[model samples]
Target: MAVKKKLAVLFIVDLIIIWFSIYSAYYFRFEGKLVEPYVNQMFLYCAISSVLCGACMAYFGMYRKMWQYASISEMFAMCQAVAIGWALSYAAASVLSEVRVPLAVAVRTLETSLLLVGGVRVIWRVIRLRQSSGMDKRIPTLIYGAGDCGALVAREFKGAAMADHKLIGFVDDARDKLHLTIHGLPVLGNRTDLSTLVEVFKIKEIIIAIPSVPRSQVSEIINLCMASGVQIKIIPAINDLIKGKISVNAIRNVDVEDLLGRDPVHADLQGIADYVHNKVVLVTGAGGSIGSELCRQVASFAPDKLLLLGHGENSIYTIEMELKHKYPGMLFEPIIADIQDRKRIEEVFDTYRPQVVFHAAAHKHVPLMEKNPAEAVKNNVFGTQNVADCADKYGTERFVLVSSDKAVNPTSVMGATKRIAEMYVQSLNASSRTRFASVRFGNVLGSRGSVIPAFKAQIARGGPVTVTDPQMVRYFMTIPEAVQLVIQAGAISQGGEIFILDMGEPVQILKLAEDLIRLSGYEPYIDIPIHFTGIREGEKLFEELLTAEEGATKTQHARIYIGKPEVIQQEDLYVELQKLNNVVLGNSEDLKDVIVQLVPLFARVS
Candidate 1:
């Protein structure tokens, strides 16, 4: 209704302008003395001009545009509409009127009408901008880049919805752009000047609008802003921008993932698509962090069908709904079955005959698995054996197991089981036609039981955040980064090889806790105390990506390396598994000892 009223008002105003323009043209041409014949035909000329011009304006969608956010395209449209309207109006007047309208008068009328019509919109847009930006309470904000993305951010802030923010200017690093103006906002200075600028301008908010740069650079800027004690926001990642365009709604708070100081992962797109496209892909534990991310990335390649298999019904249902919503046209089948149940696993394999299998189902939490060693073996060892055997039986082309850095010289029951799982797949690959491999990486930053969420929860409670140990350190990567490399590893796998991802650097738990505290707007040990608890059972000071016995060699990808495959005696592995199976079924207590025989590097934490 408001739009209708606004359009009606604009139409009435345009009609009046059309009539006034014709009269003005004649007044200017006859030196303020109106000629008799022109005056007599003025009413007929006005009627013809108003009707034709109004129709042209409607056809050009002039009244439909939100002039408050007008651009050059809107002005161009207005010019075209006015010119076409007058051309048609002149033709009609020459044919239907007794006196011929002067050619000079016709041209002058078009020029006058265009100026008045276009001027009204431009003035309205300027007035709206002034009214919105005139807010006295709007927070003074500074955009951290003066490039394309920064200019886009400035443009979005001009809307009424963003009236709460008053853009001061941009801060750019390029020497040439340092003093230039972008979108009428000046480029203040580089990152080093942030603190002084914040103090001088009393800047309450700083928006990091440099989305195309490396995250490390962003992290550096964020740290600089941290010293300014101002609220900081960042634009979405380059790929996350909608259709490669930024919106003010997409501005978000900086996350711990950004603090990792790593660039976005670049996967071998064609390689992954080649194997995954049109193939029946199956992801075990598809509801879990790594598994769900795998499903999302794989869905992009347009798989024939993505089988989401998990033990928990709720988790499986959640992922199924998500996939269905995200990839509506793609086929997705959510299966609720346990990998530990051999029959159920076999049934799923027989039904789908999935060409690509990503085995991510396993017991992973170190402390929990320490207390429940037998369950860990049942799921991580025997469960994996069941999946791999089915893959072999069903003639699957490729099978990739999601292993962990803990699997190397494992100190925990969980890690030992994962190591044992890796061994089984390697042994199976020797005889099976399927290419079996494993992707081993360190701790996923935001996985279900990872330390990141624990720190956040403690911080939210306004108390001491707990750290396992001050000295304990582990390599960390975001969940998406890990899953991307996992898929890429699958694309480049040969049978029996274990691929290790480059988990940038080992981060100390103490430093990580401090960073999290600062990111949460609290000073460590001052605002939020950090307490160090001794390391838990089955955890180590550091995790190794590869055991000394299995040295690594560089792969085709810079971030991936191939660990030398260990030769496993197939008969010996079978006998040990049989004994372990008996121990589990008999409820025996020697589970850890039996696991030692399978993974010789297993070191009992006790």
Candidate 2:
């Protein structure tokens, strides 16, 4: 507190020195030892000007900040004070008839005022340099970009509490900015200097501010920084920035979820709440990511009763506990039962009598599902059928089947099974009062089995981030965002509706790996090796949200679109499914043939 008071006093002294300099410089410029009878009034004018300048400085918050390590806004504040002082001096020295003043003298006074007032800030800056010269600054950091974000980062490091982390300049992809100074920090070359910079400067952290840069590029930088032993973090997306949540203090570690390859798709909170508000809702597979998200979202809609159904007891208990904690007043029943057991599902439907049901139970991993095609068929196909049929039988108002993007002309057994689930819902809708909908989307980023966790695990292990194929691409949406869409889609459901979400553009898998590496603060090739292991079975080069023959018609909601599939006879589908079930159970040799018959274009495990 004493040091602060001394600094404040020093600031006032500097301002006074500037004020007198302006007064004396003008006095000399006029080339006169004032002999006028009203000369004493000039001292009065100086006094008034000094007080007014001080008042202006206060208004601009100049005194609140350290002027020696002042901000650009502070400099602008100084400029304002000087300009106002000159205007006031002009009025005092010349405008009043009682005052003996010349226009030429007033001009000199204005010129000198600017020089002195501006000089105070200039001198203060110099004093800081002198004060800081002998101090051994230790903390080292790397700013990611060479552009405006980099400059903002540099400026922040110059401000309060930034002393712990010394700015070691930028690591940019653009070669043109090499050796350039951004707020006194040099653009120390390209990303190639990452490891070297950390080693040379003993860099402890890297702050990435390139929000608009591709996730792939951002990942590259994070990997570089992380590999170099520098902690890597990024600025939040534009939304967080616009909300003023972004700051040096707000800097956070780079999340592996960012490599999911799409911006957050904003959810329809009201639209979702409208459907689930005070209504009974139940979610199968409530322990799984998609199911868990559905449960959380439904609970937010103020559902009177939320039933959490899953085969895994621990998972069901976990979700039930979480839902209980989050929504104290709401009813949550955690039921542990496999969907394959129709009796258990029927009993749950009878007990809950839920108005809305989200069936998300399924084996989703493509390769795993390929290995256990019968299991995929049983869980994804039969499990969904059992749930949807139970909902229809129980007179549930609506049922939403969680479908996948690979369901669109799917080549994988998992995708085909999910597609079969969609077909079952469509067929079930035809025979029942329940309005069933299938929300088809691609991958949910950060989901239990998603690539994001895999990449994160690999990165955490040090090296060799694996990529199935450099060219592979997939549509991705955040789990929350996807759930939001599913909610809205369920609300807008009509019988037999297959709702497809807008997944934005697909992102390259190889690029995702690269970006994940970068986010970890490692150079892609130099520090973290991205091993391309070739495309896996059931892995598509690019995933589609809709089948080629299917087209989406706009619904009440912008994000949800209705998918029109090739017309199929419900009787025929049921008969075919029965045969598929028998074949899966009896003739394991005919499993591939049965899968292909049920889901055309379904590739058998090679």
Candidate 3:
């Protein structure tokens, strides 16, 4: 109703604008003397000019736009309408041999029309600004981090009732930026002054602006903001901040994923789309973080067939069922099979002949894999070889293995096994007819065993939230974003390329746990106990995405990087692999040695 009324009011104003434009144009062109001769007949000229002006405006589409989102297109249309209307008025007086108004009338009318239209728009917007000022004034928002995203958040509130969040200042990670102003919002101080800044500004909300900052840092800021009894909001990732494609609607609240401290990498969208579009694609571990996300994105590109393969009955069935419901026509198969078993994998591959494959199945728990290295080898190493070999044997076109940052300078058996698997896939690509690739990234935001869930569960249980070590930090990425990039890498891949998806920065685990505790409407370390547990065996202070010996060259995609490593002969690696396979259980003592030999950087923790 408000929208309709506003439009109706605008319609009457548009009519008045058209009349005034032509009348003023005549008055300015013909000085006082020209008007004196035809002064008595002026009322008739005015009436005719008004009718002509209305017609010109209608023809030029002057009333079709709304002022709020109205753009240059409408302004241009108004210019054209004024031109036509004023020109017609001058021509009628000259041609009809009646009241003669000079041509300058048209130019004056043009200027008047522009001012009237533009001024009214600015005035209307200003009126709305004043009306919303109280609400905007009520909530003084302090945005943390002074970057491009921070500047955008400040702009969002200044124009309209969008978020109604009044910009106060910025609280950043570096003290060097303390006195800097972004988009007119001052950078009050570094993160240390959060409590004081909140009180001083009477901040009602804190918006996080640094999308590139490690999740640990983001979490710490969120905790500080929350502790002051103020709400916290986080800007969306770079992809969501797409220029002009999206509006302030995308400037959203801080999510659980943000605290996980993960960032997105670039994926070769066209390459991935080409391979998956209209082709049969199968992903193992379908219900897990990576698999489910792969399914979600694959469905959008119109695949002819999709196979959700996983051992866990519930996970497979749920993801398969969900994808099927969303994409009704696509042929989706939910397969229950252990990737480690030769016969079962053989059966699935032969029956499906899936064109593209993403082997996501693995035993990724570090400490668990450390304790039971056998399971890690069987699942991560042997399972991967089985999938890749079968994909080659069955004439499947592409096979992309999902690897981890732990695989770089690995400390745990899980990382070692993954590294070994990467070697086999790379080695196999050299000789095999099928193209195989590996996507190595870091820990995902909300995977089955990620720290975010653990923290949330601990925080919910009340009291102690456990952290492995305050100093321990790891690179992270959002599962969905990582999965999209993984699929993209798979689509673009040809032959044996090892792509390391960029995981932005490392974040401390303790800060993450503390932030999660605070975001849940609690005071950190006081309302929630943070229990410090010593680092687990085979766990290190940090994980690496690239080994010291290896260097990376980024792909056309910003997030996807290719690692240059010396390629080994597939025949030689096969011989060593065969001996290890024969003594999978018998050589437990030498297993660690064999793994390090296979992956030179697969170091054990001190």
Candidate 4:
């Protein structure tokens, strides 16, 4: 009903405009005097112009446009409608009446009509701006980039019906754009002037709208903005943007991922596709963080069939539904079977006979696994054996174990179990027809039970965020980056090689917590307090990607390297595994000693 009323009002207004434009054109063409048949045909001329102009305006979508946000495109559309209407009306008036309307009157009418139609929309837009400007005093905000993205963001704020922000100006790095007005907002100056502008304008928010630049550049800008002590928001990188259009709601608070300062991982697409494309691939622990991402990335390569196998039925069902929705034409098989069940594992292998396998299932929490050493052994060590033996028995082409940096010279049962899993896969590669390898990396951001989520939860509760130790440090990677390198490792694996991802400089845990607090719009130690809890059982002050005994050699890819650790004899490894199995089955308290026998480098910490 509102639309209909708007259409009716606009149509009536446009009709009046057309009639007045025709009469004024004729009066002006006659030099302020109306006479004879030309004066007599003025009403006929007005009627013809009104009918043709109204039809052309509707045809050109003039009535459909929201005049409140009228722009250059709308002006161009109005011009086209007016020009076509005047031409048609001139032809119709000449044929319908004996006294022909003069050519000057027709041309003058076209000019007058275009001017009136476009002016009215602009006036309406100005009136709306005046009304909305007085509606409320919005927060003074500054956009960080003056490029295409920044301009779009500024326009959104200026043109919105009830925008909560008032765009003060833009601060760009490009010197050429400085002092120029964009969308009625000035390009105040470059980044060096950001602090001064914020203070002068009493700015409340700084929006980083440069999406396509390098992460290091963004980090630099963010660090500068942090000095100003205002809320910081961002337009996500181009890769992160939604497909169709960017909205004001898409402007989000800066996240820890943005602070990582790591550029996107450029995987060898052809290499990954060669191994994953059109192959039957299986991913264990498909409901967990790494496993689920593996499924998403593998599906993008158009695999013949994707097998999502996990012990948890809900996780399996979730990834299965996501894959089905994401890849509507591809086939997916969700198997709810634990890797520890040897019979169920073999049955799955016999049934699907997947060409490639990514074994990600494990018990990985450090302190929890320290208390539950036997369960870690049962799942991480023996469970890996069950999957590897089945892969070998079923003739799978490649098997990649998702190992961890904690596996290097471990201190905890979880680390030792992962190290054992890597050693077992390496020993099996020597004798099995199926190729086996391990990919080792550090903590993935936003994973289940990771420090980032824990810190976020603590911060959300508006209390003291707890840290394990003031000096604790750990390397981190985004989940997609880790998974991409994992798949690439599978492509380049030549059996028994442990691939170590190039995790950048380790981040200090205390500093990370402080940054999180700041990113949440709070000052560390003042607004949100940090509490230091002593390091828990089975954790390290620092994590190593490769042990000293297993030095890394460069691989073809820059971000991935190979660690040729010393391998154990197949019979000796199985004998040790048998001993570990007995300890776990007997529920012996001395499980750590047995784990140490298998992994001599493990320095057990009480």
Candidate 5:
């Protein structure tokens, strides 16, 4: 109802403007003296022109436009409508009357009509913008980049009804763009002048709009902004924008992963599809972080059937519902069975015969595994053996074990068990038809029991976040990134290869804690006290991806490397594994001694 009323009012106002414009043109063209035929024909001319103009404007949807956000396109549209209306008026006047209208009068009327119609819309737009600017409490913002992205962001801030940011200016490195204006905002200076501009404009936030640049450059810009103590946000990449996954309102806070400054991982899509497409893929521990991500990526390839196998019913159900919602047409089967139960696992394999298996089930907590070595053995070592044996027996095409960096020069029982699992898989690859490999990397940022989660929980409780050792450092990667490389590794697997991901530089745990505190909008060591606790049992100061014995060789993918350690003979490995299995079930006190014997590098903390 309100829109109809608005349109009616707009039509009436335009009619009035049209009538006045025609009369003024006649008065001006006659040189301030309205003579016989001109004065006599003025009312008839006004009526005919007004009706023609109204019809043209209505046909062109001129009244339907919201002039508050009008642009050059709207102005052009109005001009076209006025021109058509004037042409029709002159034709009608020539046909209906014996007296011909002067050419100057017709041309003057066309010009005057266009000027009145176009000018009102533009003025309305400017007035609305000024009124909105006065009413809105906009935050002073600095846009980093003077290209298309920067200009789009500025326009969005100005015209978006819900936008709360007021763009002060742009900061670009292009020499020629400096001091130039975009969308009425000047390119104040380059990034080097960011600090000064922040002070000059009292900038409360900085939006980095250049998504095509490398991560290293983005990190550098973020560092500069951090120094000024202003909040930072980033635009999503071009690909995301093109896919309709992001918009101006989709801008988000910078994550810790962005600080790594590593280039985005480009996976071998053809290789991944060759193995995953139209194949039954099973991922054990499919409810866990890495396992769930593997399922998602596998589904993207349109697998014949994705088998989500996990021990926990809730997690399995959760991922199942999510996949169903995301890929409603894709087929999936969710199975709940513990890998430690050999009979159950073998039965599942017999039924499905999945061509590819990603084994991610294991006890990952160091301190917990240190206290419960037998449980770790049953789950990590024997659990892996059960899965690998089934894959071999069922003629599975590929088996990828998700290993960890702690397996190298191990200090913890969790690490030792992972190393033992790697050994068993490598040994099985010798005689098995299934191509077996392992992907070993370090901590995932948001995985369960990782340091980041612990720190966040501590910070939430308003207590001192604890650090085991001031020097402790470990390699880290985002969960999705790590899973992508893992899938790629599985695709390119020959046999018995341990693929180590190039997790950029190691991050100090203490520094991570401090950064998390700050990111949570708190001052480190001031708002939240950080306490240094001595290293716990089964913990180390640093982690290694490869030991001295197992040197790395490069692969086709720059981020993945192959490490071929000295393999244990299958017969000998099975014999040792049998004895270890008996010890695990019998509750012997020599558990650590047996583990140390198998993994010579294993050291038990006293």
Candidate 6:
């Protein structure tokens, strides 16, 4: 109803403007000395022109636009509508009149009408902008990039009336752009001057708008911004911007992963698609972080069927629903059976007959597994055996076991079990037709039982984020990146190769804690105290990707490497595994010794 009333008012106003323009045109043409016939002609033309112009404007959707946000497009539409209306009016006047209207009069009328219509919208838009700017409580902010992305962000702030930010200026590293002005905001200085500018301008926020730059550079800028103690936000990446997903609201806080300084993983999309496309794929532990991501990536390739097998029904059901929602036509089976249950696992294998299998289910937590060595062996070792044997029996195409860097010179039962699983699968590849391989990498940033969640929880509670050891360091990768490389490893597998991902530089646990605290807007050991707890049982000071026995060799992908570990005899390993399985059932105190017998590098920590 309000919109209708607005349109009515616009129609009446436009009609009045049309009449005034025509009258002024005639008065100017005749020098305010119009004769009787001319006056009659003027009245006829004004009435006809008013109706024609109103119809033209309405048809052009002039009244539908919110004048407050009127722009060049609206002005262009006004010009077209006025020109068409004038032409139609002249035609009607020429056809119906005994006397012809002068071309000068028609031309002058059009000029006046277009000017009035277009000018009014521009003035209204300016008035609205001024009003909004006056009323808005905009925080004084600095944009860190003076490039195209920075310009767009500035425009968004100005054009979006609801935006609660006032851009102070821009800061760019490009020497040419150092002193230039962008969208009325000056490029005050480069990043080096960021801290000084923040103080000088009283900036409450710093928006990093260089989305195309490396994350390492962004992290450096973030660290500099942290010095100012101001709120920081970043624009979405170039791809997100190109997709039209970027907006003022799309800006988000810098996550910990952003500080990793890791380059974006560029996987061979065609290769992955070729491997998983139209194939029956099965992912164990589909509810866990890495496993769930594996399922999602595999499903993207239009697989004939995806089997999400996990011990936990809820996680399996959750991924299943998500996949169903994402790929409605794609088939998915959610199985809730523990991998340790050999009978159930074999039954699932026999039923699904999955061509490719991603064996990710295992006991991975270090401290917890140290206490429950037998359970870790049962799940990580025997459970893997069950799946491997089933895959072998069913003539599966490829079997990839998700191994860990902790498996190298393992200290904990968890690591030992993972090593045994890797060995067993590698040995099984010798006799089985299935291409068995293991993809080894280190800590996934936000996986279950990772330190990130624990640190975040401690920080959220407002105190003392505990670190196991100050000097402890471990390789970290994003779960998605790890999963992508894992799949790529499977696609390129010859069999029995342990593919290791190049997890960049190891991050110190203490520094990680400090950075997390800073990112959370708290000072390490000042606002939020960080306490160092001695390293837990079965924990290592540093993690290794390859042991002395397992020398590294490059693969087709630079980031992935093959570990050339000595091949153990499949028969001998099986005999030892059977003994270990029997010993686990009984309360054997020599479980660590038995693990050492299998994995000579296993260190017994009391």
lDDT (C-alpha, whole model) for all candidates: 0.90, 0.78, 0.77, 0.90, 0.88, 0.89
Better of 2 and 6 by TM-score: 6
Between candidates 2 and 6, the lDDT winner: 6
Stretches of candidate 5 off by over 4 Å are 1-137, 241-246
**Candidate 4, residues 84-197: lDDT per residue as tens digits?**
988898899988877888888888888777787788888888997888767747888999998888877877786664277878889998889988999988999998888899
lDDT of 5 at 544: 96
Model 2: how far residue 32 lies from native, Å: 46
> In candidate 2, what are the lDDT values of residues 1-606, reduced to their tens digit?
965895688557746764665556547755657655336556656666677666766676666776667767777777786677667655765545366555565566666656765676678788877888557475668888877666766777777767777677887878888888887778887788778877887778888888877766665566566667667777866444543334676577877565444555556677677778988888989999999988987887788888898999999988889989988888888889999998998899888798988888888898887777888888888888888888988899989888888887788888888888888888777778999888999887889989989988988888788888878988878888888888888877767888899887787788777777776667688888888898778878988887767888998776779878567689889888998999878857787787777787666656
Residue 305, model 2, lDDT: 84
Candidate 3 C-alpha lDDT tens digits along 84-126 = 7767765675566554554565567667877886678767766
Residue 345 lDDT (model 6): 90
| Residues 1-606, model 1: lDDT tens digits | 998898799899999999999988888888889767788677778999888989999999998888989999999999999999999999898778888888988989998898999999988899988987574688999999887788888988988878898889989889999889888889999988988999998898999988889888888888788778788899857765665467677899877787778877889999999999999999999999899899999999999999999988998899889889998999999999999899999999999999999999888999999998889989999999999999999999999999999999999999999998999999999999999999999998899989999999999999699988889999999999999999999999978999999988788889888878877888888999988789999999998999888899998899999999988999999999999999988878888888888787898766
How high is the lDDT of residue 322 in model 1? 89
lDDT of 5 by residue, 1-606 (tens): 887887788788788887887788888888889888777566777788888988999898898888887877978888888889889988887666557777888887887777777777777788988998677687889999988887777777866652667778899999999899998889999988988999988898999999889988887887678767788888857664553234666677877777767788899999999999999999999999889998988999999999999989999999999999999999999999999999999999999999999999888999999899899999999999999999999999999999999999999999999999999999889899999999999999999888888998999999699999899998999998999999999999999999999999898998788767766767787889999999999999999999998999999999999996686987877788888988998999889888887899998777
Candidates in descending TM-score order: 6, 5, 4, 1, 2, 3
Specify the poorest-scoring 10-residue window by lDDT in model 6. 240-249
> Which candidate has the top score in TM-score?
6
Selected candidate, larger TM-score, 1 vs 4:
4
Score every model by TM-score.
0.75, 0.68, 0.65, 0.76, 0.76, 0.77
RMSD of each: 12.3, 12.2, 14.7, 10.9, 9.9, 10.9
Those runs of model 4 whose alpha carbons end farther than 4 Å from true positions after fitting are 1-135, 239-250
Return whichever of 5 and 6 wins on TM-score.
6
